[model samples]
Target chain A: MQLSPSLSALVEALRCLPGIGPKSAQRIAFHLLERDRSGGTQLGQSLLNAMDKIGHCESCRTFSETPVCDICSNIKRQDTGLLCVVESPSDVLAIEQTGQYQGLYFVLMGHLSPLDGIGPNEIGMDVLERTLANGNINEVILATNPTVEGEATAHFIGEMCHQHNVTASRIAHGMPVGGELELVDGMTLMHAFSGRKAI
Target chain B: MQLSPSLSALVEALRCLPGIGPKSAQRIAFHLLERDRSGGTQLGQSLLNAMDKIGHCESCRTFSETPVCDICSNIKRQDTGLLCVVESPSDVLAIEQTGQYQGLYFVLMGHLSPLDGIGPNEIGMDVLERTLANGNINEVILATNPTVEGEATAHFIGEMCHQHNVTASRIAHGMPVGGELELVDGMTLMHAFSGRKAI
Candidate 1:
């Protein structure tokens, strides 16, 4: 179907969002044009504002409007010697939601995907290594996801930390706190059994 | 967790889109900030451009860059005497996609909802009446959906057409093409049976 030029452009632009297909893009375009023009305008302005203002934190590489993010700057979060290394800013938020971690964070923004040409430098591993070598951090927590790439990235980071003589630990791999044993997958079961501790 | 001001604003702005909840909004915001900043900027510019350029067609109320839409101004679609009244601009697109209708369209953008205080004038019903009474139209197709409100709006328009001495007809309702009888809803089956034709 031949949409108006502006509408077609809007649909094409909307496809840039993750998981939004052509049909969804069309629906969103019509929705913006038909019911909420002002809201669409506001969204556009907000997108511009975020794009212009937000950048990676200098200390941790997480998204921030400032060079150093809120967590990195706050004196109250005093665990500067303990750094949790994560794959992305979203992972930082997830960990923050737990309220258990008092340390600072290092956001890689991605894992080491050799097939996709994403290596150590691609995910800010060089920056992480520099931070570790500079030496305020006493321990590093490998909180990358449990996927194969995540595992490889964690192992690489662990090796780097070892070379720097810093303690490095991986987050536990086991059944989730609320997960039922029957529904747990075999790999998780194996990990849970192998990593079990005596109460 | 407190996100940066611009990031928070972006997340909130993303919520304005239909079906985007807070979680999805946050994910999209992070995706734009972390992975696709250039794409986000392009999307922002596109949104602004679409909002600035697209407006309702003065004649048909469908979205258009011009005052009158392409369909309304096209010389080849000469069946100006046959008007198809629809509930929304999306409905206009659906009908146009069928390629069966050569007539002009009258978009209501909404059906008559007394409870919502949306009456005849609210959805441009007065304009429809004016068009019908001007003696240019001979037939009005009531293609408002099959919902109760759609039915009510169609009935009201049908009455207005009768008052203006123009023929009014409702689109057919029945079992959908290729629909299985057992899986069809009772209401649709009833409609199919009652509206059955001779083989």
Candidate 2:
């Protein structure tokens, strides 16, 4: 027999989540219908509110309900004149968690992916170039991931910074502090050796 | 730094889904915001619709958008005078997928668990008892999971069936089909021996 109409719709809709398969969708649907209707309703309302209100920061291209994000608007952070470039808002969150950096950010949202037809314009490179040309920033820290696409994206942005006469620096690559050398991948070891400095 | 209000609320609300933690919730929130706002909004509408409409089947206690679920409202299935009892509506879906069971069902929605304060009433045993008292069902099949609590619940319901002079049968416990005998658990092997049937 067919599942109840709304139940089936909820199960089908839940597959919009990244990792959920049919079974997981059904399980989640049953869970909400059976145990937590209120939570489900709350999530529904939250999703609607977020999708409707959350837009990109006009300055950094990161998620923000306001036109300019908190970090972008902070005079203290803006005065630092150091803009860290990265892909995705989650990276911004990670860097903020460290509480080490005291500057603003420029979120690429994605990197160059030529084969899939993604290019500089697709990832808001034009905006980054405009920010660089404004010349308020002292340095551009490219903290994009070390993957091939991330590297290519960083290289492209570095050229833009050079054109605008802004200093550009790629974040250092080395062995992670807490990782064991034996378990580390060969590529990481190679980078560690190449990037070594005197203590 | 604080996530934007709606973004943070979406992240918090996403944790209501089973198996989602803070990190996964954030990832999902970002993914939807960046890549699939339409899908996210669709899920929101679906969740609202399902949560608002879906309720338990009046007859079997399975999820239903209407007063009675499709299976329970079927005259052909109900006239068969058989009622299969299961712990959750998902089990009914599983059984329906097999295309084997031909009768109506009675869903407990949960099993007896004294330690957690769950009892017959919590599992809707009173509903089952009423169905039996109505004197329409000839047999009651106990198809709860094979865990210890499930076994105890089945036993309790079996006693209830006996009191009402209704035949009750637990789903067989033995090695699964296509399972390797050597790899089967010891308890399953023992049950296989005890439940062996002659061709």
DockQ of candidate 1 relative to the true structure: 0.81
Candidate 2 stretches greater than 4 Å from native: none
**What are the runs in model 1 whose C-alpha is more than 4 Å off?**
A76-80
Per-model lDDT? 0.90, 0.92
Question: Taking the tens digit of each residue's C-alpha lDDT, what string does model 2 give over B112-165?
Answer: 999999988999988888999999999999899999999999999999999999
Number of the predicted model whose TM-score against the real structure is largest: 2
Best model number under DockQ: 2
Query: How much is the lDDT of residue A171 in candidate 2?
Result: 98
Q: What tens digits encode model 1's per-residue C-alpha lDDT throughout A161-195?
A: 99999999999999999999999999999999999
